[model samples]
Target chain A: MHLSTSIWVWIAAFFTLAIFSFLYKDNPFYRFAESVFVGSSAAFAFLNLWFFDVKPKLWDPIAKGNILYVIIPLILSILMLTRFIPKIKWLSRWAIAFTVGMGAGLGITGMIQGYLVPQLKGTFLPLWVPGNLATTVNNWLLVFGTIFTITYFYFSKPIKGKFGVAAKIGIIFIMVAFGASFGYTIMARVSLLIGRVYFLLHTWLGMV
Target chain B: MKREIPLLITFIAGFLIVVALFIPHPPFNKIEETFNSWYIIVAGFTFILGIDSLILHNWEKIRRRSEGWPFALTVILSFFITLIWGIVSGVRTGHIFSTNSTFRNYFYLYIYVPLQATMFAILSFFIASAAYRAFRARTLNATLLLLTASIVMLGRVPLGNVALIPVISIAVLMLLWVLVDELKYVTSPTQRLIYIGIAVVAVVAAFPITKFLYHNLSPVTDWIMNVPQMAAKRGLFIGLALGGIAVSLRIILGIEQSYMS
Candidate 1:
């Protein structure tokens, strides 16, 4: 049987086995692998930001003829690094505030444009479909399911009678949704586990 | 100025972008574009703060000779080593992720991806434990969940529909058993009749349903996903978006000052 001779493949196998070893118990190998994962991930993120975000957005304009335009952001970015200095740490707040504001701004606009509007548009379906029983049923379910789900979250007043019934229906829909989500999440993790196992077998050990 | 400046900055940045949405005029659109770019730059710099914290935390642990300090050292060493190699290689190749770069080919592909995927893969075991906690499988909700989750996981396997029969049986039986047990609390004859009626209906309906599912399990899964899941997801998304917009407005209005601290 052909075995993987590559050192990198061996390294990957070791790390994979090392991580899997945690399933039995946390030991030195597992600890080392875990730490390396953290450290290397951080480094990778650092390199990515520098190359993709910082270099192009911050450094390039300054190096080019657009220094006048980039001066503000440059100053703000430098200010962000001032958190290391205790005396002038407050100055970093300016930069932090900018990011927070931008996030808040994007949150509002994005929610409206990306999520809320589209969802509402999707939900506003005609309950009746001409000569299509399944479509008609699905439209009714969508309309009622959405309305009921929203009613479940409505906490301004005490729910009772018909309203309570609608809220109960909402809870059923929510639980079903959560159940499906849980199943899907577990399946996704299972797929990842399968991929690792496949790599260990076919790539590393040449065992199908 | 410490508090006021941040609050003011958050307000101005948030407010202007929202205004730019409604009025995409020359200055407004330009301001939105500039602010967006600046946001990306500033956010990128925030990673430095994250790395700084990680390094300092591990460094302090190492200095103190804390338990697992060697692992911390491993962290620091790997971080710096990877960082240095990446930067040097980036300088050499004009990019850190160049096709020929060892950082990408060996370290990233071999080391980082394997570690990352393994780490996530390890969670499947934890998720199994979690499923034990989650799916007690007595109530209709739990039974439905168990059935759907099993369907999803096994839907792609050969004879997948064959595998699903037992699961559906178990789930249906558990649900029926739960209803049967609830009869003790139901002193009313009509309520007891309702329970028995449901069980009988379930027992009778199981035949055709199982027949359909024995061949159409994948289609059933697709229907569950497309119809109920999407409907619920849409509802949740709408609610979340509305809530997010409210909070965002509060931040822009400077009422949400928690970020300032």
Candidate 2:
């Protein structure tokens, strides 16, 4: 039982245990740890934003007398704070309008280029390869799977007979895919568990 | 006038961004980049709103001596401690009132990281407990899902694959046999023909040599992932893209003003 002599390790271990104590039941220790976590993270984000973004990009440039480009965004940012004032809250809508407009615009182009075009291009697989039977079969399955899955989500008309069968096949494919995703998710969570355990054993107790 | 102006702004911004994608002209190309820079500036300033909300909520709790008011106090203390430490110590080094690294590293590493990690790690236990209850095979679809999930989970870990290898080999052999046998019983001529072709292919692939090839659970899981999972994901991506474009259009056309409210 070679426990860590370092106070930092002890502190980390205590907090880790405090959080894990929620499994037994939520307690003051857990609440204290959770509060500290939330506060510190919020503070960290604030500091990082100020230092990395506002300081370098907005503040320094304006301070250096490069005010022409920075002025519009500065005004927009101050306008955003008008949300706090009840009478002037409507003024903040302009800032929201600008940001949301820009976001929507960028999002549309991004979705087309990044997702729509690429995914459409991906569906164009050659079903009949000369020698590669496995590859050929896989491609055929993929094409049918994609078509049927998309058809399942089609809501304009009633699905019956062939379309119904196709949708059923699509459901099967979706279920299997969901199952695979669930398994992977479980693995991810378990990996986090392994990490915490490793920290406790190796870092705190020297028990690796 | 207020509503119309914002809608017009949305239209102009969205249209220009979309148009900028095709235009190679320097000014048009810079529009998106300029918008992005403004977004960052606006987003950076909005952090104050979030901090103010947190402070107000916690302060009210503290003032009322509400349930878990001590926790609220801890939150406020930790926030200021971290804020002051980061500001005074230059975020990376120089301590103001104290010279030791205690104020800086202790709060971040000891409290924050451990708390975050342990919080996430606790989910593993909950998921495991949930899985135990959820993985029952009461129907054909449920059984298929369970089987696939079992294969994937087992395939991901070393021990599970070792246990699954022989089981998978047997299952594949059984599937091939079932495909062949089912070919004889179908009524429709077209279905029979398709079944025959599949059976023939399965027979050829079901050779003893193929047993050596699929001696692990990985190939089965990989096949399921590559064929079914990839197809479903692509379908979803396409659907999401279409939906996103529609929403963008709605916002741009002033049909969606819910965001402003």
Candidate 3:
């Protein structure tokens, strides 16, 4: 029956309950909690970026008189700040350009290697195995299912007759997959609820 | 000049990175890491833009004395309190504000984490209500979706599996029968050819495929996930990859000017 004595724990419990109150209806408590959450989160992110990344990586070296390499990045960063100035907002585009270009480049390559290659490889399975009959059947199903599903998405040719049947099978697979995802999502949300409930009961009310 | 320069930058950057993937040389291999470092610094500066917007918005609300202006005040105060505490305290162990400063930690632990988690947790109620409305069986597709969702939900939980296994097994068997029956009445020659190919392969395998079907909730769920779910996901992944490459090409070629705007 021992309750949480820490004042921080009490504050946390209050905020948790304040947020949960939204389920009933929005109120001042919920709004206040929401504001505090947004403000603190932004502040936290800002501080972390400043302390961990900008300070150590950019600022410290320059401050310590190692100024040669960091100059370009420093200039780029200042250009990014020009977005606030309406007159020179166009200058900010250079910074945006660099970021977006790099992002597009990196993303394209990474997706090819990480996602496309692996998924394509996954589709390539041995249909018939000597001993493992179940696995073999599952592999066959996987191959056919992949082909049919891909055909469902093919927009070049009109789907009719046999293609229609395959597409129908594809839709069924997609729906069932979506249902599985939804079920998993529900599980995640319920876990969070259980955590909050545990906090209320064990931490706030001292009833385990 | 404004547009062309950015487009050129995009082309050069994208091309270099793409080339870097194949080339294992010093400067080429290091291009991503170098660009990432630069990007981080630039990204850090952009947060200032965000903070500026937040401040301006809240200040405007306060000036106008809008509805719930006090809440706006709360936002501003919390922002400054958190920002000042972090800046004053310093990140590392010891500084002007002592190493054991609980102020920043208190706000982060008590306010931030709980609010975030509770916000997400609140979605559960909404989802349940939404599911209640959306799960109505109006058509064959809707009925199938509802049935699939019900089975998945029931099978996911520990205790539900014991009660729901037989139901899920029956459902799976029914679904398999439907699939088989659907395959039987294909009128299209191409479809018949594909079916015949599969049948030929199955006959050559000479294995009792039905033995693979498990009469349990977990196994049924596994079957759904491994077979249909994975295939659908792979289809999506391939489609997305193609779409992404196209978009990236457009960006590199200066056709996608939306980002510049």
Candidate 4:
């Protein structure tokens, strides 16, 4: 008979307990769970690659008689294997260079499209609204905050007069945002920990 | 011949693929997709390399009878066992770890969900600890932080306001006070000047800014995030991408001996 779904559930709960035990104290259970995680993840990654990528994308295509199909990948893959070779180890540079070059080119293009044009455009928001002090005040604050913060990042010249003051205020806003991000990140990580605990308690020990 | 030709091919092929984006051809797209698939295969191999390094590092520690030897052994053993199990299952026709096998059920139930949840769960205690420190309210900034944090925390839970209106109102008042008249007292004159100048400069620099129509609590906050914030993020992102490229190039080219070493 196929492994029942319940077995999987039970196994999960056990690992959860294993992880949660860490909060109490770093112990054997946590170590066991962490180890299993690494091993399983590695094994799964390899299997999935063999199943999905190397098999269909490379191996299958090559076998189908596209003699030219195998050349580059085969060479690259073999070159990659050269790490095992003691003397001719430098051959792996080609693969690295190719990957890096492409990645850099993609990043350069993305940076322009993603950041520069959009930010400069935001500074021009309409601040004056008829009989809407709250909206007007909010817009003014945003405009002020964005400018100063950007200025704070730019250290080309000494900030003087009004610009310096605004930049300080802008720093506060940025800090607040960063704090929120940190809080949220902590929440996410903690939640994961709790999940492991809950799994251990409910599934492994059967104690709610 | 093998080495020089490959390097030349690397430079030429890399440039061509990048320039290929400007070309509106189906083959260009296909080549991009092929590269993506290759990335997955390479990533898998990288994972193996990582595990190997981990094992090697841990093995040395264990052999020397250092601290945490048990943990190291546990890691190495688990890795080998899992590999053996998966391989055995994959080789067997109807085995559970076979392709699209039921092992995924085990992975999902026993591993992924629990790990994810546990990671999130650990935050509760940390939040409580942070709240203790940040909510002390010794200073005006501290007070503001406490108020916003309390509001947000309460907002996260259902019936927060209904159950704790007094607390919520107190926090809201603190926020309002800071935002209004209190801001002048707290913000230094130099800072104020910077704020005004920035406001003026931002207005002047508005052209060529990306406009995003998205929902948010504050329009001003959204605008800042979408525009200048996005720009800053993009700059960092570009740097990160370039770094990734450099690292990848180092590895693929075998110029980087750290991994192999």
| Number of the top TM-score candidate | 1
Docking quality band of candidate 4, CAPRI definitions: acceptable
Residue by residue across B13-126, what tens digits does model 3's lDDT show? 888888888885889879867877777777676566667788789889999999888888988888888888878777554432344665546765676778998998888888
User: Against the true structure, whose lDDT is highest?
Assistant: 1
| DockQ head-to-head 1 vs 4, winner | 1
Model 3 residue pairs with clashes: none
Which scores greater on lDDT, model 1 or model 4? 1
Interface C-alpha root-mean-square deviation, candidates in order: 1.4, 2.1, 2.0, 4.6
Over the stretch B54-143, how does candidate 2's per-residue lDDT look in tens digits? 878999999999998999998999888888887867544533223455554666667677888998999999999988886776666786
What lDDT score is found at residue A81 in candidate 2?
Answer: 80
DockQ score, prediction 4 = 0.26
**TM-score per candidate, chains pooled:** 0.94, 0.86, 0.85, 0.69
Q: lDDT of all predictions, in order shown?
A: 0.86, 0.81, 0.77, 0.57
Which prediction has the highest DockQ against the true structure? Answer: 1
What DockQ, between 0 and 1, does each candidate earn? Answer: 0.77, 0.60, 0.57, 0.26
Q: Write the per-residue lDDT of candidate 1 for residues B1-261, one digit (tens) a residue.
A: 788888899999999999898898989999999899888778987776767788999999999999989999999999999999999988788898899888888888999889989999999999989777856766666666666667766665679888778866875787698888898889999999999999999888887888888888788778878887777777787888888888989988888888655
Off by over 4 Å in 1: B154-158, B172-188
lDDT of 3 by residue, A1-208 (tens): 8888988899899899899888788899999999998777767767877776678878899999988879878888778878888899998888888888887888889888888888888889998988999989888878888777777886567778887888888887777777777777887888888888988898777989
